[model samples]
Target: MNYRTNPKNGDKISQLGYGCMRFPSSATAGVSDIAEVKRLIKTAFDGGVNYFDTAFVYGDSEKVLGEVLEDLGIRDKILLSTKMPQFSCKSGADFETYFKKQLAALRVDYVDYLFIHNVSEKKRWDELKSWGILDWIQEKLDKGQAKNVGFSCHGSTSEFKAILDDHDWDFIMLQYNYLDENWQVGREGLKYAADKGVPVFIMEPVRGGLLADKLPPKAKTAFDNLPTKRSYASNAIRWVLDQPEVTMVLSGMSAFEQVTDNLTTASEINAGGLTDNERSAYVAAAAAIREFMDVYCTACGYCLPCPKGVSIPDCFYYYNLSFIDDMASVKRNFAGFVGNGNISACVGCKACERHCPQSISIAEKIAAARTRFGL
Candidate 1:
């Protein structure tokens, strides 16, 4: 697999890191198909994928991943990363309690990389600091419990910048993909991180499998008509790898075919390695994807500062994502904006609609977002 050097510590991380959140589910809820999970991880391990990421919030995946790596005798062969649910931490002692639980579940005394999971607001980071999370993190590093420390952000660009600057992180993770190039940190945030010598690990590189498998017919045709053939997954993945600022792209591979396909692309694609035709195909496909959205909202801040605090662009972003991703996962992630930006906050005053360049029915779409995301 292709590897990139971590700017903070010089560790060689696989360009294609394994995301354990989407492990194939079994008949029982919250339980993954362990046997199939083993096969998939084994295939990836054999194919030279060394970076494995899981999280405390991903149900039973830590234990399952721990079992798979232990049985295969490859625990030490990979760069293991698991997230700590820092939002739930209220007291100083809660930090160690959660960290130990994750370590025990993963069957590892220490993780190669440890992240503060899903920081979505500056207030949340501030609360964690008040609760002594910084001291706890330093303890983990000093005691050799976590080799590298950082955070995975699901907040706005401004929030991302604030949190990134607040810590001397060994690495940071962001949700990035071809379709999501302007969301969250986007390309500019990646560049910002690079400027400070921070290594960036990308999550949602395929937009929750939307860009990979659920492309609109027009976008699919655009990719299929390319002179060089590639899967829907390959085109989206390679596009993210095209930027040198991206240190790694994490793929949650649930199938054997996915493992092999991702391995092939990881081994071949490098920074700025996409050819002219592939680049053209990306533009064509992106335009088609945008054309399929319910609203023509280009996520320009034109409709910002809504009277009711509605995140117009964000609401529509996830609203468009609803057409592609699974409803369950969409709702869960969309829950982050519950009180602040969730479309339920909209008062339908036409305040934002007046400034919309696309003249979209802002109230109507916000209502749809509210219902679609189960707000």
Candidate 2:
């Protein structure tokens, strides 16, 4: 378990923090299997993992973590990181209400690292502040209920910059992976936060399981030629660790095998870990994957000022994924754009395509989305 110093508060954090979102299901239904969750956490701790990240909505994860850690008698041995759901702030008083509930759920009096959960859109933070939730958090911090204050963001770089300037945070979590280097905050946002002295913790280091599947036939040859040895997952994880701006990379491990595999890579690796040539192999591989996605849609939303309220980039992203690959994220991404005046509302207007520099033929893509996602 290699560790890095939190730039703001200087607390050492393990580079491979355990995310508790995907604990194995109990009935093979939806409920998380506590016994398996416990074993995985125990194995992680025994193997030197010290960061345990959970949230209120991860379906009994807080309770499972609390029980496991208490049974192991290692409450103080690891960092207890959880989030306060921003949407829970109905009033200033609800802050304490929700925070206390989280404490009870986790069976802990104080959280080592607490964040404003999932600040994906700029409106999320604003809505919370309108209800005085930020003030409530500060009060809790002053009262020692939360040791460190921060947020986990999925918003754009500009929004993240504003949030960094708006508050003094001990750490910040962002969705960073090999594929998303140019996505939100991408490389620039990461450096911006690091320069401001905020320790950056990374989530979704593998693009939410997009990189772990059997390599495409074209790319398998390149991976097979590697010298030192690596799996597709290991190489992807190593790429994130290679970046200097990232303090820790969080992996949501549901299986003991995953825990074992990740621990081996994380324990042996460090900053400046990958060689120049090896790094090139990964970059080349990622390029090949992008070559599979020839759309060149940066997802910049330049085509979004759609008059018909259609989600243009979103429609294309899902359409491509559903037809071209079996990745689960495609369906997940599609679901979000289904309601409202989404792709189904395209109305065959080529106005958006006219504005698109990529000349993507927006109406055609929307028709494709209708067929692909059953819209």
Candidate 3:
């Protein structure tokens, strides 16, 4: 696989890092299939993907990754990266508590990359600082428990800049995709971090599977007209890798096919790999997708576990899909997905909106879904 060197520490991170957030789940229940998870991880490792990213809040991701890598006896063969659930930290000691648990979960003594997760606002950063997060990180480094310290951001470009300037970050992660070139830290934040010699890792390169599947008809036509036919997913990923500043692109592959496709793309592509014609195709496809989208939700699921039991992301997904695909099929699937918690159950609590990184008017969107679907 193609690899890029992190300027800060000279670590050769794979161009395609395996994101462990969305492991395959059994159809009977939401439980992850451990055997399938192991197979996917083994495939990625055997394919030369060294970076495996997980987090505490990813619903047993860390534990499962730890178990799989250990069973495969390839923990040392890969770089283990995980995050501190900053939102769950109430005190300084909690940092150590959570980190120790992470280490234990991974069954590893040290992490290759440890990040303060989702440092989206200055207020959160300041709170973390007050809790002695910097010292805690230094302690981890000194003890060789964490090789690198960094953060993932989901805030305004100004807040992103402030956070970058506030600390000596070894790396930075952000939600970057062709559709979000001017959104949330965007190209400007990317360049800002790169200029300061900080390597950047990209998350949501496909906007949580939105770009890969459910393509707008116009967008699919744009790609279909291209001389070299590629999956919409490949186009989205290549668009990100076209930038020289991106150190790695993380894809949360839930299926074996996705793992295989991403591995091939990562191995063949390089910095500025896209040709002029290919770039034009992406530009056209992105425009069409944007024109077709109603909510712009990435389906990241951050605004989840709604107090009112509403499936906010599902509501938005079906609403958007209704426009691009057959409305009857979309509605049928939406019925099963929503089950008892339809959009009409929304109570206007605005709790989901508070956590949404996109700052989408989630309650308003739910209302729109009810109207569009005649729920």
Candidate 4:
């Protein structure tokens, strides 16, 4: 597999970092087939994936990863990364309490990379700082509880810049894809962090599987015309790898087939490997995908902090997906991911609309999404 060096300490991170959030059968039944999960992870590790990312809120993901790694006796063969649930913190002590629990769950003495989970806005970061998050991180680093510290963000470009400038972060993770090159902390943020000598790990390279499956006819046609044969998913991943600043691309593989396919793609592609024709094909495919989307929301959290707590962008994302994909899966994700911030919670307040850069009618779209999802 292709590997990139961590700019800070020169650790070799695989281009295909395994994301542990969507392990098969884990979310729907609240139970995982441990044997199957272990096989999938072992396949990935044997294929040279050294980075495994999970989080406290990912519902037993850390435990499953720990079990598989230990059972395989390859715990030291990979770099384990997980996040602190910043939203659950009420005091500085909560950090230690939750972290110790995570360590216990994972059965690991130290996390190779630890992040502040979902730091999506400046206000949230400010509150985390006030709650002594920096000190908590330093404490972990000092005591060897965490080897490196960073954050995953879904905030505006300005907020991302502010956070990147504020700290000497070891790395940063962002939602990046061909469809979201100009979206929240997009290519600009990727370059900004790289300029400051920070490595970037990308999540959602396929926009949560949208770019990989159920492609619009035109998009499929564009990819079909490519001289070289590749799956839509491979094109999506390679497109992200074309950007030299991306240090690793995380794929939350849910099945063994997915693991194998992604490993092959990762092994074949390298940074700046896309040719001019391949690049044009990607642009055409992206245009076709955009044509199918009903809303322009990129799921950036800029229009967040809605007084009514409506998950505006998330609702729009699933709503748009429902038109092009299976309604049942859309409903499941809306319920699973959106939670209490479902579109029905919108109070018709235009607070989010005023902040939206896309000029979308926030209330109108939420109402439409609510009706479409039957929420």
Score every model by TM-score.
0.81, 0.79, 0.97, 0.85
Question: What are the lDDT figures for the candidates, one per model?
Answer: 0.84, 0.77, 0.90, 0.85
Residues 1-375, candidate 1, lDDT per residue (tens digit)? 888988888988888999998899899966999999999999998888899999987879999999999999999889999999885677888889999999999999999999998776788799899988899899999999999999987667788899999989888988887777786667788889989999999987776566876677778888898887877998888998888998998998888888899999999899989888888777888888887578645454457778777778877877887786677776676676544355777888888876553468999888877876667
| Model 3 whole-model lDDT (C-alpha atoms) | 0.90
Q: Could you tell me which residue pairs clash in candidate 1? A: none
**lDDT over C-alpha atoms for residue 107 of model 2:** 90
In candidate 2, position 281 carries an lDDT of 76
TM-score of model 4 relative to the true fold? 0.85
Q: For residues 194-229, what per-residue lDDT tens digits would candidate 3 score against the true structure?
A: 999999999999997888867888888887888887
* Candidate 1: C-alpha lDDT: 0.84
- Residue by residue across 1-375, what tens digits does model 4's lDDT show? 999998889999999999998788845576667888999999999999999999987877888888888999988888999998876788888888999989988999999999988787788788888989889899999999999999998777899999888888999999899888988899899999999889999998987677886577788888889898888888899999888899999998889988999999999888789989888888898898887688877554557778877767777777887877778887887799987345777888787775554568988888888877776
Root-mean-square deviation (CA) per prediction: 7.9, 6.9, 1.2, 4.7
* Clashes within 3 Å, all models in order: 0, 0, 0, 0
Quote the positional error of residue 44 for candidate 3 in Å: 0.8
lDDT of 2 by residue, 222-286 (tens): 56677877667777788888778889899888888888989988987887888877777766777
Please say which candidate is ahead in TM-score: 1 or 2.
1
